[model samples]
Target: MDAQVSINDSQAVLRLGSRFDFKAHREFRDAVESLLGQAGSRNLQVDLAEVTYLDSSALGMLLMLRDKAKATNKDVALVGVKGSVKQVLDIANFSKLFSIA
Candidate 1:
C-alpha cells in the first residue's frame, strides 16, 4: 500500500492506495503514528478510494488506530470508501466503529 499524509485544518488525512494487506502493516502503522503525533490534528481520516483490496490485517490495523486515537481523544474516520473495500468494511461492521464517508 502507498500511504500519503496531509494535514487539513484540524484533520490529518492519510490517503492509501493499492492493496491494503499484511505487507502494508509497517507503513500503515508508521503513518498512523505520525498523524497521531500531530498536536494540531483533532481528527484522523483514512482515505481508501484508491485501494483495490483489503484483508483482515488491514481491518485490524484500522481498529488499532481507532484505539490509539481514542486514548489521545482524537476521532478517526474512513473516507472515500467504495467498491470492494466498502463491501469488506460493511461486512466487518466498521460503520459502527468508525465514521465513514
Candidate 2:
C-alpha cells in the first residue's frame, strides 16, 4: 500500500492505494503517526477507494489505528470502501467500529 496524507483544520485524510496488506505496515503506521502528531487534526479518514486488495493484517492495522486515534480523542472513519474491500470490512464487523462512507 501507498499512503498520502493531507491535513486540514479539523481532520487528516490518508489516501491509500494498491494492496493493503502486511507489506503496508510501515507505511501505514508512519502516515498515521504523522497525522496524529498534528494537534489540529481531530479526525482521520482512511480512503480505500484505490485499494485493490487487503488481508487480515490490513484489518488488524485499521483496528490498531482506531485504538490509537481514540486514545488521542481523534475519530477515525473509513471512506470510499467498496467491492471486495467492502465485503471484507463488513464481514469483520468494521461498520460497528468505524464510520464507513
Candidate 3:
C-alpha cells in the first residue's frame, strides 16, 4: 500500500494505491493527521482511483479517520472509487457516513 498526500489551504487530497489494508495504517493516519493539522484545511479528499483492493481493516481505518476528522472540524470525502474497492464500500454502506465522489 502507498499513500501520497497533498494539501493546501482550501483542500487536502490523499492518493492511495493498490491494496488498502492494515499495512497502510500508519501512513494513512499520518497523512490524514498532517492534513487535519493544517489551518483552514476543512476538506479532505481521499483519492481511491489507484486503489484496487481493500479489507475490513481498511474500513475500520476509514472510520477512525472520520472520527478524528470530525474532532478537528474537517470533512472527509472518498473520491474515484471503483471496482472491488467501490463494491466493498457499498456493501459496508460507507456512503452514508462519507461523501463519495
Candidate 4:
C-alpha cells in the first residue's frame, strides 16, 4: 500500500491507495506531517476515494490532522470518500468534526 500526496491551489490532497492500518501508520503520519509543514496554504484535503480499508489508526490520523489544522488556523476537508472509508467516518461521526466534500 502506498500513500501519495499532492498539492493544488490552497489544498493539500492525500491519496491513499492501501489499507490504512497500523503497519503504515508511522510512514503515513510522517508523510502527512511533512506535507503539512511544507504547506503554507490554509486548506487541507484528504482524498479517500481509493481507500479500500481503514481502521482506528486511520481515524486517529484524521483527528491528528484536524487538530494540527486547527492549531495552525487552517481548514481541513475530507473528500472523495466512499465505501468502507465513508462508512467508518460516518459510524465514527467524523463528518461533524470535519468538512466533507
Model 1 per-residue lDDT tens digits across residues 2-100: 999999899999999999999999999999989999999998999999999999999999999999999999999999999999999999999999999
* lDDT for each candidate structure: 0.96, 0.95, 0.90, 0.81
Model 3: which residue pairs collide? none
Candidate 1 has an lDDT of 0.96
Deviation of model 2 at 76, angstroms: 0.2
Q: Output the TM-score of candidate 1.
A: 0.98
Residue pairs with backbone atoms closer than 3 Å in model 1 (clashes): none
* Candidate 3 lDDT over residue span 1-101, tens digit each: 88888987779988999999988899988887787787878898899999998999999999998999899888999999988899999999999999997
What is candidate 4's TM-score against the reference?
0.90
lDDT of 4 by residue, 1-101 (tens): 58778877777777777688788788778777866776566787877777789999889988988888788878889888888788889999998999886
Off by over 4 Å in 4: none
Quote each prediction's TM-score.
0.98, 0.98, 0.95, 0.90
Q: After superposition, which runs of candidate 2 have C-alpha atoms over 4 Å from their true positions? A: none
Question: Is 2 or 3 the stronger prediction by lDDT?
Answer: 2
Q: For model 1, give the RMSD to the true fold.
A: 0.5
Candidate 2 similarity to native, TM-score: 0.98
